[model samples]
Target: MSRRVSDVMTRGSRALPLDATLYDAARIMRDEGIGDVLVTLDGRLCGLVTDRDIVVRGVAERRDARHTPLGEVCSADLVTIGPDDDLDTAARLMREQAVRRLPVVDDEQRPLGIVSLGDLARAGGVDPGVLSGISQAPPNL
Candidate 1:
């Protein structure tokens, strides 16, 4: 019912190694003005680390932010979609997973780009209000 993910996805998401310190991820997020970043291990997709992850899993837990690797706290149970997949698939994935953002992957499950709820709305395939209500709606309102 819509274009492929690659047609609308924001390509080349900002990424960092799984071993990166929580401080490192936070710094990058701040510098990039992004809420989340793709996490990797040995140059492959591993998990996703968001600002909330750092706050709840790192700060709230009293972990050593400078020493703790993101892999320890990032959300590893990802819901991803292929670059060639339709926006319908993306919408369904978002609905079923209850996530606001999804990592678009290549055939080998390598991170290629990212698609957010807004992307679907912008694509004109889904209801904006409904998608916006999903978890992690952009803080800007």
Candidate 2:
């Protein structure tokens, strides 16, 4: 009797083009009130950039947000969950991957929605420390 990821995921249109700069990604996130956005290549999910990624990778490293492509800042490692997956699966993935957010995809890998620790918490799920670890800024910052 577990809840599906789709039940609590954020269904916002927040995907960005691969050619877009980090500044574009940040602005979209700021306007949309999202931490991360899915990056697309020819309308397909390629990677993702998050607020943490922006601060840690884009800012701390002195990468020029306006010139640095989102694809450059986005983690090359892509991880995802299905819309039908249970929240426990999402939580476990978050814990194991040390990621705060995950893109919800269908079998064909189409972008559906996004699930995050905050979404789970707002949906009455507990953080359980793992989520906090994911959100914490690096010590160097």
Model 2 stretches with alpha carbons more than 4 Å out = 125-141
Q: After superposition, how far is residue 40 of candidate 2 from its true place, in Å?
A: 1.1
- Model 1 spans > 4 angstroms off: 128-141
* Candidate 1 least-lDDT 10 residues: 132-141
Per-candidate total of colliding backbone pairs:
0, 0
Cα lDDT tens digits for candidate 2, 1-141: 788899999886588888999999899888878677898887778888888889988899999999999987887577899999988888888777777778988887778888988888777654566556666734221
lDDT of 1: 0.85
Q: What is the Cα-based TM-score of model 2?
A: 0.82
Clashing pairs in 2: none
Which pairs clash (backbone N, Cα, C closer than 3 Å) in model 1? Answer: none
